[model samples]
Target: MTNPSSRSTVLSTSLTVFAPAKINLVLRILDRRPDGYHNLWSLMQIVQLEDELSISLSDKHSSITLQCDDSSLKTDPSNLVYRAAAAVLEHSGRVIGLDLVLAKRIPMGAGLGGGSSDAAATIIGLNQLLNLGWSREKMARVGQALGSDVPFFLFAPSAIVEGRGEKVAPVRIKGSRWVVLVNPGFPVETKWAYQQLSISRTGVRPLSDVHITLGKASALSWESVLQAAENDFEASVFKAHPTLHRVKQKLLAEGAEAALLSGSGATVFGVFRDETAARQAQSSFQTEPHLKVYAVSTTSDF
Candidate 1:
């Protein structure tokens, strides 16, 4: 989906933007590419659960400064948000600096695309604040360099992501649904998940079948999407961490329409019929002190 260029009308030098969390409705890992990055086909969606970004143009400071509520997340160049800001400055060929205040609410390494969303927000925020007038296509190019999932956020709130995650084809699910995300309060290293999958790559789906599934998905309702939800990582990931499997079971037991681990996850999300049921499910998980749960709705309009 090509986002048409739109000029920013905000006259202020500062802006606060919403950086929503994302879930993989369906994740299919294809063959390992020659570059070692696995090719993938997935249906990715944005949820209302989000981080807030307060970004302002800094005239006095010559370099970007980033502050995060989560101290565990680095504020330096190592951070994707920082890299995104730098990429914009470098791409725009402007010497302007930025003060980025990231109010992080999403858990890291839960496969929620928290970091990627922050990066995309930074790019979008900077484009408006700096008046760069760059189209989404240009911003997405910068996003691709930051991370595989970064480009996906540029095209959100839903899309069919493919080809090492750089290829994005935006699609609309006919309706919205509620999502209940349960984090086991632990991090799942993405590299480790890939290594585990490499050892057990026995059931890799044919790329053609993935296309067929997604093609049919375009015409389906939210219920049909839940019925069609699949994740290639679940098999190996659940085996490695049995607790995640129980989380999925708990979600199902609590009246979730469908439940699955999101991406290479330590977090499992369940689809629900409405906000009330999703909130009820969130309450049920509260009994488990180790779990962090959130009740959020799907967002089709970004």
Candidate 2:
């Protein structure tokens, strides 16, 4: 499938962008490539939980400033949002400055693609604010330089991601569902997860079963989608952090249709039959002082 279009409407100088968190329904690590990056295949979906970005043109001729509610995040050039703004300015040759305010809700390093989604929002927001009118393909190409997952958000809501995360194919699920996300109040180091995975697996697997299934069907049913859900890092990650295993079990026990780690995660998400069930499941974790839980549903592309 071709890349989808970026949905941005030209507004006033200020624009508020929604940057949603993503969950991987299925993740498979193929092999470590010569470049030192692992090849992967994943089915990613966006959840209603999101970060809000407010972007506006700065009156100062050549200054860009970013502010976030989370002081732990740097608002400088080192931050992905700042870098994304720079990329658009450099790419479009616009001499404008920007003032960005990020209201973050997505947890960091939980395999939720929060940073990548924020970056994509910057590119998309700037494109509309600056009137660049770049297509989603162009924006995604620019996003790739920022990070592997950045490009996926350009075609977000749901897509098939593969090949070190540069390849994305938009897909459709039969219906919407609710999700309950449980963050363990700490970040999982992605680098460590990859290192552990590299040692655990012997070699690259052949074509993924998900890919083969998609080749025959135009779209996937909810039941079929659940049946195909799997994660390659679960074995190694759960071995390292048994607590995550208990979290999954708790979710299942609390009425989740299915539960799994999002991405080498400290966040475990449970798919539910409905929003009420999802919220009910989320409440079960409220007593845990260290856990941050949310009841959210699947969202479509903005």
Worst 10-residue stretch by lDDT in candidate 1? Answer: 1-10
* Candidate 2, backbone clash total: 0
TM-score of structure candidate 2: 0.94
Structural similarity to truth (TM-score) of each candidate: 0.94, 0.94
Error of 2 at 208 (Å): 4.0
Query: Candidate 2, residues 1-302: lDDT per residue as tens digits?
Result: 34332333345889988888899998888867899898888888888888989888877768789999999999999999999999999988888778889999999989999999999999988887777889888998999999999988988778889888899888877788999999988888999998888888887678666667863565777787787888888888999988899999999999877899999898999999898898888888878979899999884544
Lowest summed lDDT over 10 consecutive residues: which window, candidate 2?
1-10
Alpha carbon deviation, residue 300, candidate 1 (Å): 1.4
Q: What is the Å distance of residue 41 in model 1 from its true position? A: 0.2
> Candidate 2: which pairs clash?
none
RMSD to the hidden true structure, all candidates: 2.4, 2.0
Q: What is the C-alpha local distance difference test score of candidate 2?
A: 0.85
Model 1 residue 65 distance off true place after TM-score fit, in angstroms: 0.6
Residue 7 of model 1, lDDT score: 15
